[model samples]
Target: MNNIEKIIEIKDLKMTYGDKEVLKGINLDIYKGNIIGYIGSNGAGKSTTIKILLGLVKGYSGSVSIFGKDIENENNDYKQKIGYVPEIAKVYESLTAKEYLTFVGQIYGLSYEKCDDKARKLMRVLGIDYAYDSRLSSFSKGMKQKVVIISALLHNPDILFLDEPLSGLDANSLLLIKEILYKLKQEGKTIFYSSHIMEVVEKLSDRIILLNEGEIVADGNFEEIKDSSFDGSLEEIFNQLTGFKKHNDLSSEFVSILKEV
Candidate 1:
């Protein structure tokens, strides 16, 4: 592991929001070309961690290094090698897909002609080229998601931070995106995939890190994690590790309550 290229490193990472401790001493190292499934329940600090790593959050206590440089050093060069898709689609509603994507590509230092050409080609490949000239406000959830994905990759980043990227995609789009991610991994791109979809995470990740109560409780490959927890599936292991095994009982109780009405 030491000989491999370490792309991201977190040491004793801690963050507090008002009185709530969001991250409680997280220590992790991400190597190049690895797809990491960073899963956790809501408010378990998964997004917070990613935000900090992306330099969007501040006042965190600990050290974070990207590309062998400390993030706190105020060096913005590392950001050029990274791309991020937020949990929410926050595209400019009034701008056409071409306009928005072209602006994004330009921000990454691409020429206007290059950005426009690449954007058009990518939109065409995704089957959304017909709407490229239309306002983003008219795009469906899936279309907007596809645009965001394209914008993030326009810079050819070495690392990708995707937070719930498959939120509103259809089956075919989802399958294609999964294939794209796999191909990206083959090309030595590190992917930090944060999602609640256990099945996708289980199948896609080279390594999985499970967070519960602001701490990593499980970290390993699928088979290793299963063996360690003595569980059958990733979902079962997630339930066991997160200490949430009452789905059946909870459902039954809810049903009984409904019957009373």
Candidate 2:
């Protein structure tokens, strides 16, 4: 609504790598307390746009503003209100879960004692407190993902950026996480969720933005997107919008090749 605060603004955004263009003139506005599902296939500029928004990537041409402040300006204070869980969990394998979480919390301006206490409590809540003292190297993919999620929320950020956040989570954890995101939105926190799982996106997102090639092909709610294309589910709409209708053909060809002598 017009009364709600605008948390993120991007205008004429564009990025390139050498001769290849990644993002081509993206313009979008996101409001607080919204769960925005940003979906795209491989090389569709999804990650690139997220990176630029997070200040992790450079050489992008556009005007990006977060929390009403221009990110291009000299001030980096806006980042303090942002939390990000990258597509890959990059942890210090040598460090224990407690140690790593404590370190991350401290980076967010938390005191050592406070960070340690908070990390322990969070790990307990996530049912991973038993492995608190264990090195990250000993943790499974799902465990590591939980740790990353905790670290991102350690500061209780106003905005959360998640890429493939539920990648290796179990069914129970996945359901819990979805509930947690809903609670966070109720608290007026903005969530920018990027994933290839159309079902989850369809269920969780207040709005969906689908990108293709280097541009956005669709942006709306599930019903609106469906109405824009043929009547179908989100996955079918995605396939239609992306111009991909060859799943059976591709699978048959793949199996035929495997059958070859």
Candidate 3:
């Protein structure tokens, strides 16, 4: 992204909870139009880093800036330019799909008519408009996830953060979402995509950032890293960096334990 303005900057970020340190020290600079794949194993500070960027967790050491302004100083208005679909979407199951999206739009200061129009179009495109008036509690896991996607995109944000956005999506829906992500990048919107699925990240991300134990272990594209770390897939590379080598015998070990008992 030559000549593109920097959209995010994080330096020496650190966080702690009680006696445990979550994020040791993180440093990164993300530019406009970047499809950044942020990946790490469980408890690697991936969630903590994202929470801090979203301004959910304060009292962190180090500096973070988004849109050239210190994140700590940003107000609610700043959040308007960003859309976030969390890993676990906590929605009001009692509300109909339409009502839930409408409420979300209202929170972003959108008019009722505008929200309705956008919601209708998005739901239709995602092939879930038939469930529009249905209560979320009655929907399957995949259906509810579609609603969450529509709500996040209703405002046409400048930057999008998707944490495991494909968690419960079906094959068709997953393909559609992948295509949508490509389109978003084409439109010059910066995106932070976080997930444990290595294949998805490898194919979509322009650059990949690996985090381990609260620190960045690798930062590069798939090909850039494939040369040294692993000659093949992102999953292989991840295993290498994360020291997950024992998986080859896990099934055998389980079988042995079962037989013994």
How high is each candidate's TM-score?
A: 0.98, 0.98, 0.96
For TM-score, candidate 2 versus 3, the one ahead is: 2
Candidate 1 residue-wise lDDT, 115-219, digit = tens: 999999999988899998999999999999999999999989999999999999999999999999999999999999999889999999999999998999999
In candidate 2, the residue pairs with backbone N, CA or C atoms under 3 Å apart (3 or more residues apart, or in different chains) clash, namely none
Stretch of 10 with least lDDT, candidate 3: 224-233
Off by over 4 Å in 2: none
What are the candidates' C-alpha RMSDs? 1.0, 1.0, 1.3
Cα lDDT, model 3, residue 13: 98
Model 2 lDDT per residue over 162-260, tens place: 999998999999999999999999999999999999999999999999999889999988888878756778888888888899998999999999999
Tens digit of lDDT per residue, candidate 3, span 1-261? Answer: 558889999999999999888999899999988899999999999889888888899989999998999988777576888899999999999999889999999888899999999998898998888988999999999998989988888888888999999999999999999999899989989999999999999999999999888888889999998876477689988988988888879988988999994
Ranking by lDDT: 1, 2, 3
Query: Which ten contiguous residues of candidate 1 have the minimum total lDDT?
Result: 227-236
- Output the TM-score of candidate 2: 0.98
lDDT score, candidate 1, position 21? 96
